[model samples]
Target: MTKVLPSLLASDFTRLGHDIEKMEAAGADIFHLDIMDGQFVPNISYGMPVVEAISRTASIPLDVHLMTLDPEQFIDALAALGIDMVSFHIEATNHPHRLMQRIQQSGMKAGIALNPHTPVAHIQHLLAEIDFILIMTVNPGFGGQKFIDTCVDKVRTLDALRAEKGYGYEIEVDGGINQETAEICREAGADLFVSGSHLFKSEDWQEAVREMKQ
Candidate 1:
């Protein structure tokens, strides 16, 4: 079965504690945090303080997505927190292999995220160097965007690469993932999913997550 990782970017920040509590009760496996800086992406979002705030209330593991330039400069700060996983964009880093090693050394799961236009082949050399792969189905920066149909092929390609090389990296898809697209991604070999607006904006967050896993 695919794992459901609720994107905290979609959670109600005004009542974040309660919003997270509700999601935990609804069987969310992980909390996906999108930390964006204006330089790497078009938007600027929460930093460590916000993640630290949610960290205090979250019951499940936190998968922190760092969409920023010079991610190496911030790994130490993020590692100080107790998040389970930290993923940085491959395009944002100067040395992705070294970054992955540093993340592992810091005792957090290491992950690499790919943009919609970036092919899965970009990480082929580093496949054995990371813990997970985050495939963005929509452009980064903002939420509420439509799913990119091309991502299904990307996920399949990544899956085929992993199978061919026998890597244990978890394939994660973020952005524009809803009930319908979730199944397509899963069939393409996505093991973990990140859903934001689709969960919190929907009438039923629990049902949204449950249906996405199907």
Candidate 2:
């Protein structure tokens, strides 16, 4: 079954607790949190305080995506906050294996994210070390961007690589993921879908989420 992870970036911050409760009730598998630093992604998103608050109310696992210059700086803090998974950009770290080890040691699943332009071959060696790979369908800075059509092929490539190498890392796709794009990725072997604006802006989140899962 496909796992639908609703990105909290697009949720109403004023009613965060209520939105989280509604999403949980609607059967969202994971709560996708986007953490950004001004330097790395050209946008600053919520930090530990917001995440900590979300953790208090979020019943599902927190899938934290760190779009920062140095993701290692926050590993210990995020782990201490009880984050279930932490994904950092492959371009941001020189020693990704060490980071992956550190995250696993901290009892969190480690993930590597690839920008739309990045090739799947870049992280082939570390495939077995991480828990998942985040394929950014659009640029990583902000939300509501249109999906880059070429990224669907990247999913296919990663899926084929996983099959060929017998790896177990989950293929998660973010950015512009709605019901239509989710189905496209699913056919290409992406199991986890991170949707933001589409899910949050809908009048019926339950039906919206259900449609994405289908």
Q: Which candidate is the best by lDDT?
A: 2
Candidate 1 residue-wise lDDT, 98-199, digit = tens: 999999999999999999999878888999868999999999999999999998898898788889988889999998888888888988999998998888
Residue-level lDDT tens digits of model 2 in 85-124 = 9999998999989999999999999999999999988998
Tell me the whole-model lDDT of each prediction, alpha carbons only.
0.89, 0.94
Which pairs clash (backbone N, Cα, C closer than 3 Å) in model 2? none
Model 2 worst lDDT window (10 residues): 121-130
TM-score of 2: 0.98
- Which parts of model 2 are misplaced by more than 4 Å? none
Q: What RMSD value applies to candidate 1?
A: 1.0
